[model samples]
Target: MRRKLTLKDIARELGVSISTVSKSLKNSEEIGRDTKEKVQAFAKLYNYKPNNIAVSLKNKHTKNIGVIIPDIVHYFFTTVFRGIEKYANSLGYNVIICVSDESFDKEVINTELLANGSIDGFIMALSGETQLKNDYRHLTEVTEQGIPLVLFDRVTDEIKCDKVLLNDTEIAFEAVSKMIKAGRKKIALLTTENFFNVSINRELGYRKALEEHGLAVNENLILRLPFNEQIDGIYPFVSNNEIDAVLAVNEIFAIHAMGILQSKGMKVPEDISFIGFTNGLLSKYASPPLTSVAQHGDRMGELAAKMLIERIEMNFVEGKEEDFRTEIIKGTLIERESTVN
Candidate 1:
């Protein structure tokens, strides 16, 4: 009874990255001739066969792109989808979308389902639970199996794939600095746990802005809310804190805080100012029209799609190797009625 060899096993045996083993087994020119021969010999000696999904995908052209997002209800996700569909369709391809609902299990399921000969490639954002667990084996498996994958927004470095990102830290810094310049002495951050990369970056920006302005970084002023918790979950923190301004990581928190403040007779931009991360519908239509850092989800999606399509078309030819790229899109600070004029 012998076990089948996997990419990780081959990589560990050869003292190389899983990506290197994958490319080598595919006979990519990116791998040195010596390494490629060694890897191929090892694979043959161990009876290693590529995953059926990857083999099937490579043998046929589905002309369908699969996308998995954390939440479809989110304005940012919807906008990104629009951009992906627009670009993919223009190139004579269709898209299949799945919602992970912030669950790691769902993310794995969606990816596996899509990979089973249904789509040509994948574009996704990491789920909250996936980030919390810090487990990217499912994503890694897809890549190791020679599937083209592109990650956008909530991405992790553990998976070597093309990524589209927002300059979240820079965007948050600018938004927080705006509040500080408006004389906000006690600014606070409303965010999720540091497990989420986006939240962590925004928190960093928040801290950087305060420290650069000679303001003390108060640990107590930072509130980490549960992901997608009810609006009421944020009430007690805002009620008890003396925060003159708040930098929320998303529109949900920012809009919820605004309602809570108004209910407590605190006027926006008068007693407490706020700036949120996403410049979506809520930010634009909220009472007082929330000031926001407009992360261009559409542009990120377009770029991500473009990258994935390019990789898919490359198709791992004998003389070609994929060079993964990470594209960072800058955000714009949209001034509105939520902040002081």
Candidate 2:
């Protein structure tokens, strides 16, 4: 292996002190422009990369924000990350992403890992286990230390901080209404998990819409798994039931429902028109294109990043730091063949 290059190497090459090389690389005003340019060129030629960790230590900024999620492989979360990465990069910042895989203990450890100046702020969605455990002392610890944070999607009301959320209840109502309009009468609600307030909000929307349409709300139709967990039993149960249509709380359950229904000799749209939320990539690529509630994931991410950055700047300035701010991003309906008339 080749020996790595360093600032000392640049200093040796430039016939100057390492301190001069340091100030020049940092673009400090004390260094003359000609000298600074010469040092920078040498450093670049030698492929000398400044240590971000050292830079962060000196400036008290990682220019890196922490993001915690249950799973990065999920289509919805991936889309959200795409949005976040784009915005974070455009603003000269990086993201320190961590996955807890729905483990409450893991989430706490990840949050604590970022607390020691490793991240300037945080933008995240709560892990499924974190919500179940309902332990938010870690979140509050970051906030109390004056670290900026913006919670999105799976945020809890217990934590008093800035948040960017979708109008889950309204969209849920619309999903149900769309199914009804498409001539599907029995719309079953399938959720992946149960502890999230957002999921509850979406379920409430389903009920509110069903009631508004003068349709009797059927308790038997709502199937919530323990811990809001997913199960293979749902496939056969859905096949045996007289379910005409389904309003999956999110895309994963919705796509899975379609497969289960088809396996039982049911044709989509002809047998049951469906509408899934999240407008995730899978929804568009499903055997039959899925009509969906396009949760502006990119918009959610941008909004969350903007909020956290603003809060960080605020805390760095004004010093008022008393009240927390709350905000919501609106979701849109994306019509597709899943509910074709």
RMSD of each: 13.5, 2.5
Question: Across residues 1-341, which tens digit of lDDT does each residue of candidate 1 receive?
Answer: 86767899999998999999999988898999999999999999988987655655667868889999999989898889988999999997889999999999999999999888798899999999999999999998898878899999999989888999999999898988888988998998999878988999999999999999999999999999876675576889999988899999889899999899899899988999999988999999999999998888888888999999999988845326557789999999999999996
Tens digits of lDDT, candidate 2, 82-155: 88888888899898999988888888899999888889998889988889889899999988888888888999
Clashes of each: 0, 2
Give Cα distance to truth, residue 84, candidate 1, Å: 0.5
- Where model 2 places Cα greater than 4 Å from the true spot, the runs are 1-19, 25-41, 44-48
Best by lDDT: 1
TM-scores of the candidates in the order shown: 0.81, 0.89
Of the candidates shown, which would achieve the greatest TM-score relative to the real structure? 2
Q: After superposition, how far is residue 300 of candidate 1 from its true place, in Å?
A: 0.8
| Deviation in Å, model 2, residue 290 alpha carbon | 1.8
